[model samples]
Target: MADTGDNSKTELVQELNGLLADHFALYTKAKNFHWHITGPRFRDLHLLFDEQAIEIRDQIDVIGERVRKNNMTTLTSIGSVAKHTQVKDQDSATLAPDDMVKELRDDNANMVARLKGMKELAEKAGDNATDGLLDDWTDMAEERVWFLSSFLK
Candidate 1:
């Protein structure tokens, strides 16, 4: 890959790390909801949450590696993840099942927006690999949002 110049590379790295942090935060939120979900829809909601959590978890390493592939360090700790993440944490486990679905739906929609932002940065930097990966990730987040939205209706 050709160098996209230092400034472009640095900006791409920052955006990518922000994305990685969001993946971590959202993944943890999904798992937390999975574990705490209860009520008549417990089985369905639990499974859905777990599946979404796994999808997000699977992307974490890929996103982090993209940062490394760009010759930069990725996020190193929970504090750093918190610092960079735009996704808000759902620390209280008391949310109703419908609320859980709503929160996750909204968060996944936010992920799509974040992914699109990263894709634009990647494209501007001429980072084809990152740009392509972000497209797939954006698709995944959109699908998750679709599935979660169905539960709300």
Candidate 2:
């Protein structure tokens, strides 16, 4: 509501934190699927999951840079990610191919939703740079969701 400088900066920092947390969770879930998937679809699903995980890992760098540009510290540790992230972790040895696909699809969808919400926040803060970063991630997540969901159907 107010056009105060501190409030705008704080809002941007909070939004960045939330986005970082969600992406961290998505990245972990993708890696989990990559490690655990097995069955008739093993090769396809495994490769797909690995690619998606790497994409998320790349996004982490982009996100961290944006946070630093905003004059805030990036939450870069595993402990911070585990504490702040909303997506649940999986036991890498336990999931079947179908289960892995389903879990990753869900995580991608969730990440897309979170990024969209963050985009709105970034726009409100007049932070087009962060909004553009989220736009790229949202598209990537949606594409991954489609690819992962195809394994189930």
Candidate 3:
């Protein structure tokens, strides 16, 4: 791993940290909806949210380590996660199941967009590893968006 230039390295770290924060936010929201969802479709949605949450959670550490591999500090606290995340938090446990699915779908869509941005940044930085990892992350988020959209249809 040769140098990526200091400025490019910093930008990549910032983007990666922001992505990491968004993933954490989305993971928590998915778990919340999984636990609070109620309706005739409870079993299907419950399982869906759990599976999505697990996938998001699994990649979180990988994102954090990517930042560390660039010799930068990743988000340290819940406060940092809240500050850096573009994903909005959902506090209502009483939201309709359909609405929950809609929100998650939109959030995952946003994540896909964000991952694309990060991929571009990685490419500009000449960081092939991060760029490749972003592809996997984008696919995961897109899959979640697809699954959540099924509920809307």
Candidate 4:
């Protein structure tokens, strides 16, 4: 691929791909927790998790499209996701409600960090469109972290 005058284009795309992978992992884990959570707050947590998962899924699609806009193919398959994702995977087993909330809080915090990093990369690469997108994504992830943290308290 020819350089678009900015040498950071490739690196920026790679970072965006990582963000996409993290969102994928987080979305699956949120769905897992949604399915397995039980206890006093079952209904509330279940609904929250499902909503968060859908939002994360939508973010993943936006990110993949961004990659395409940057002229790179999006990552595909679980293997590719695993390679790029920095979010930790959870066992496919039931978890206590508090534990599920805690895990998601930490993961969302991590996602916020990743989004910030991507935002910086996009700025450095002069990719204003991606930088703008990251602003919305980072705000959403930060809200998830806050809500999950509050729930655990």
Candidate 5:
């Protein structure tokens, strides 16, 4: 049997790790778009992507702090994040502005799904703090997806 304290902490750590991985992956993808996007939408997309990347980075710190609060180590390496994240890195070099928007929309949707799953896990584990954190992330991701999808319509 697992000790109660450690078990709860472990659960929180696992959820946090997954959240952190998603955040990092999103960050990379956003930066990729920011650096590679071109065409008529270049100016707007470049600034938007930069803003979005910053938002993801902010969430990363929040997730890392949550892990630390749970008395667990945070995963900080690219390899570790890649291994844990469900988000896929894209080949940005070949993508057009519309493609970039579509990719980000898909990524935001993926993140929303992941955060919802994490929220359920947090609730089951009685981790309100984590649930609250995920709630914020879910809202932001949904908003981002909406904005990105609008560009393609």
Candidate 6:
């Protein structure tokens, strides 16, 4: 594979594309939960879901751009994303608030797992840029874990 400036970034680019697909699916489901969640903590869950969805949505574009920067084609069509994403679509619009919280928390944990794996790959490729980015992404995702866990208990 050709070097992307310094590193042969094929693996990193592929990981980033996978991240984009996963996060995009998660983001949409976050919004779906935001719109449909109902329970005693309706206000709290609604706001939290909306904020997370926005954060994931913003990062989706950046992840796609990173793929392009690394000389790889990004997933654009919904079909492509569906094929690539590890995250599953929400099965119901009328989920109880607890179920919504549990589902999103699990998804965010999965995202963190991928981010950590990417960090290792980035380090191996000597792609300092990707490694640094993954650090922030991982930490932020870990915090989401904390918040969600707190909500669950």
Candidate 3 — worst ten consecutive residues by lDDT sum? 1-10
Q: Write the per-residue lDDT of candidate 4 for residues 75-149, one digit (tens) a residue.
A: 989999999998899985777888889999999998888888777778777888999998999999999998899
lDDT at position 112, candidate 3 = 94
The whole-model lDDT of each prediction reads 0.92, 0.79, 0.91, 0.89, 0.84, 0.85
Give the poorly placed runs of model 2, Cα more than 4 Å off: 1-6
In model 4, what lDDT does residue 24 have? Answer: 91
- Mind giving the per-residue lDDT tens digits that candidate 2 earns over 73-141? 878688887777878877678766787788888977887888887766787777877778777788988
Per-residue lDDT for 13 in model 2? 75
- Give me the candidate number with maximum lDDT: 1
Q: Distance (Å) between predicted and true CA of 17, model 1?
A: 0.3
**Candidate 6's residue-wise lDDT over 27-145, tens digit each?**
88999999998878989989999998888888887778777766679997999889889999887988888888999999999999999889777876676777788898898889888
Q: Which regions of candidate 1 fall more than 4 Å away from where they truly are?
A: none
> Which scores greater on TM-score, model 3 or model 5?
3
Could you estimate the TM-score for every candidate?
0.97, 0.89, 0.97, 0.94, 0.91, 0.92
Backbone clashes in model 2: 0
- Please list the residue runs of candidate 5 whose C-alpha ends up more than 4 Å from where it truly belongs after superposition: 1-9
lDDT by residue for model 3 (45-126), tens: 9999999999999999999999888778999999999999999989999999999999999999998998988877888788
Give me candidate 2's TM-score against the actual structure. Answer: 0.89
In candidate 3, stretches whose alpha carbon ends up further than 4 angstroms from where it belongs are none
